[model samples]
Target: MRVLAIIVLALIGSAGAEAREAQEGRADLKHEILKRLHDPNAARRRDALLMLGTFTDVPLSPILHSATDDPDPGVRAAAIMALGHASHASNAQELIPTLLRALKDSHPLVRRAAAGVLGRVRDPRAVRALQEAARDRDAAVRAAAVEALGEQGDQAALTTLLERLRDKDPFVRRQAARAIGRLRAPTALAALLERLVREEDVDVKRAIAWALGEIGNPHAAETLRTLSRSTDPYLSATAREALKRLISDATARSRRR
Candidate 1:
């Protein structure tokens, strides 16, 4: 009994010492990464900012806040995603204001990056900001916002998503259509069905078809059946596949009932 007690105490001491060593190593690595933040080259600074995200759930804290306004748009954008890596709740909260501010950044790249980070953070509070960003003058930024709103999957964003369906940019419209599906917005069924007929962009059409399948309203079945016979092989195949998926989901639901 005495020998067993000594062995257990030694193992515990060794584990504690190893944990301390790991903590010190992590601190040293962070110090090195911080030094690179001031690198003469913007690309180097951006790379350093991204490297900070791999710090194994360590909060970048004060440094991350300042980097949000870095002169290089790329660095600022990297800061956006790095903020998502913050493991501490308080540190992550610091990003909320910065993310909102970045949505209005002069550079479209910064705005788009902020939108994506907001989604990755998965904060419901960002839904309103994402909705406004969806109307950004830059189509890519608008698309990013739509994608972010989709990640949120909030029904409140359905209106903004519905409006974006008519955005002048085909990419924005396609993303909005896809976001609607992610939100499972039932009100969008009519719009998607209407767009399927007049939408000239094959990519946007495909997105709408997919959204219809995801929504899976009985009314959409006729459209899917008709499209199943389309001369466009991809569209026909997608429609046929969507029908099967919807039918399967409906069957599963009915059985559960």
Candidate 2:
């Protein structure tokens, strides 16, 4: 009994010491970041924002929020991303407004970062802002916004996502197809089918096929069957796998019925 008590005490002491050391380390890191954030060099300030992203435990929201307005677009973008890392379910709603504003930043990089982070936060309030961003001039920004809208999982954004399927940028079109797949809206089947036939980009076609499979509507089976025989190995394999999922899902539904 004495030996067991001694072992428990030793462990408790060791854990206490480790916790104190971690706390001190976080304090030191916070100080360093705060000092660099005010430095004259924009690069240093940006690097500080990136470092701040790595430590979410520090009380750094005020500093990060202010950094979002930094003259340097790169620093502003980094600050937006750091805010995303600092956010959790409890505080995500509070951060949505900042991200929404960033989504409209003049710099495409800042807008793209905001869209990406808004998606990660997955707040319903951001849906409208993200929808607008989906029409951004920059293809990358549009793609990121489309992806974020899918992440929001609000069916209300489905119309916007479907429209993006016809975006001139093949990458945006691919992202739109993927976002639609994530939503798994059966109503999107016809649009996806139409896009699949017209899409010249193999990657976009593959995404359409994957979306069809994800929707799991039996109506898509015929199209998937044709795609399953494509000479392109990745598309063919994806189609075959999608067919399997459709079969599995349909079988499960029938059993439940």
Candidate 3:
């Protein structure tokens, strides 16, 4: 099959590129780099997919688009990963449909890679997909999806993330909290501040404190200032530092106003 051949060639090319990445022979084989994206060898295909990500990104848009749908999971994962490295908006757009499809791939790695790449693409349509992924059965996939949603920084997914902060798994809760920090939603302030006050887990509490500081609300500023005066040294120290940053930020805003 032509698809099989493409996969093979791609694998071989990828291997060759890996071998030649720092070598003079492969460095000059620019033409071969373009050929690898369509290589039929699955192994070669994987190599080419990786190289294309580092090589001809903008010009290889059409190829990256096609690579995302490769029948081989390895190829699909590599292509999706490569798409994340593409700097051109147009090139990134062409891969969106494929990345979206990867979200549902039977292969967990494909789903994970797709989730991460979607974050890099920053398309609004990906918000829903990432939200769905946040609930995936696999912890790694769920975390990746949560991270992707945070990367998009879309307000639409804020409620979903807020709910995730209570995920049964501590890893998921930690990631959700970290992602909330990335999102810095004002609506998230109440929950994060509450978590800061109530969470017994040191790491989660630290994340909550950081999230409040990131949101930069004066409401949080007041609470953090209050926490600074508490007997628990760690919480007090974190709250005090956060309060300082918030105060400095507020002063800057006031001067600008």
Mind giving the per-residue lDDT tens digits that candidate 2 earns over 145-169? 9999888888999999999999999
Estimate, for each residue in 104-207, the C-alpha lDDT of model 3 and write its tens digit.
99998899999998887767778888999999988888889888888888888888888888877777777788889788787888888766666667666666
The lDDT, on a scale of 0 to 1, for candidate 3 is 0.80
How far in Å is the alpha carbon of 42 misplaced in model 3? 6.3
* Candidate closer to the true structure by lDDT (higher is better), 1 or 2: 2
Highest-TM-score candidate:
2
List clash counts for every candidate, in order. Answer: 0, 0, 21
Q: Which whole-number lDDT from 0 to 100 does residue 225 have in model 3?
A: 72
TM-score, candidate number 3: 0.74
Residue pairs clashing, model 2: none
TM-scores of all predicted structures? 0.85, 0.92, 0.74
Model 2 residue 124 CA deviation in Å: 4.5
Error of 2 at 227 (Å): 1.2
